[model samples]
Target: MKDVDRGALAISAALAGVAGYVDAIGFLDTGGLFVSFMSGNSTQAAVEVFGPGAAVALASAGIIAAFVFGVAVGGVAATLLARPRAWIVGGATVAVALVAVLAFGGETTLWRVALLAAGMGALNTLFLADGRARVAITYSTGTLVSLGLALAAAATGGSRRAWRRPLLLWSSLVGGAVVGAVAHRGGSPFALSLAAVVLAIATVILAVRPSTPERRPAAER
Candidate 1:
């Protein structure tokens, strides 16, 4: 995060917020399943295998597979496109918009869930470096871990500001989740539509802004 510029950091935070917002709606609608937090979904799937049944586990597995497929598609786009950030964000906007459309049309829950998961999976690829996600926007576990490590480093007389980026990402996600839960009371479609709008704005910003050169980690160099 120290290597990343302010513009990229701000954009990454906003993208994480969108992931949290969409994930909250999907989690509520699905009664427990997550659209973005695959680690949680993996745990749920493991428990469902014993508690609910294999069928339920299979459904969770399907969501996970959709997320993986989205990552693959986003990875390819990032590799092939000159403007990876804008194109990838645009793709995520389309996926979330489709979820909103399907929700409004009374489409099955499964389709909406799949699209949400896929969109989030693509969103995580926004800060990819060396074929790995530099920032995991959809899930906070890694962010929190990074925060902890940064705090430790600071306590040992390292850079005191090192923890700011991780803390910002985590806070954005939590704030977005709170807003998402509130908006969800109106309807999933409405909430998801708003999320799509946010993504669209992000896409436009990425399109207009000068591209930031990604800084690879020391190990990668």
Candidate 2:
């Protein structure tokens, strides 16, 4: 197989799509709480705290904590282990699969939430190198911001190639969201399981790829 590093941006975009799909599940499950995107959750937390009372805010806080802990786990694994990116992606698939099973079994506690968050957190490690997040597969705000900048740069006569990566990533995410919504209609467990399958495929691709060159702590494309 060709080296994935050579097509890192493409793989990252695909991962972004998976994240969007899972995130859609979380959104539908929680009625607006984001499992992968903490910014959205934080916003919801604040709103709940002020408007809906402490119960909702508490749940949001727990999700945020889970996400944060998952990020820490993924980051540490990448920094301390070999083939860190592949390991993280593999772990993410497993975590997601577990969450899917639990959901199928009618589990809806914070433990399941933590597993989902951890899966999302592990995905962030796909672009981890030099101790920083690269493309941010789990969130779209940065990707959208980068897209705007890329377009602005192009409008100022910069090369349009700079815009290609972000545009693709954003499109992949939105496309995943559409698929996720549809899959969710079938069943939440099915949608979650489908996401796990996608991540598992990504893990296989990463497992077969050659080692990448040293990376800088730059934002994902």
Best by TM-score: 1
TM-score of each: 0.93, 0.89
TM-score of 1: 0.93
Q: Which portions of model 1 show Cα errors greater than 4 Å? A: 212-221
lDDT of 2 by residue, 1-221 (tens): 01224478777888888888888888888777777888987887898797856787888898889888888888887777777777888988998898888897874676687678877877776665456676767778887887888889889998666777777888888888888888989888888889989888988887777764323334632
Model 1: pairs clashing at backbone N, Cα or C within 3 Å:
none
Deviation of model 1 at 108, angstroms: 4.4
Consecutive 10-residue window with the lowest summed lDDT within model 2: 212-221
Candidate 1 lDDT by residue in tens digits, 1-221: 67578988999999989898888998888888888889888887898897747776877888998998889888888777877889889999999998888888774477679877888898887777777888878789999999999999999999898899999999999888899999999998899999999999999998988664633445754
Error of 2 at 163 (Å): 0.9
lDDT of 1 at 84: 86
Best candidate, lDDT? 1
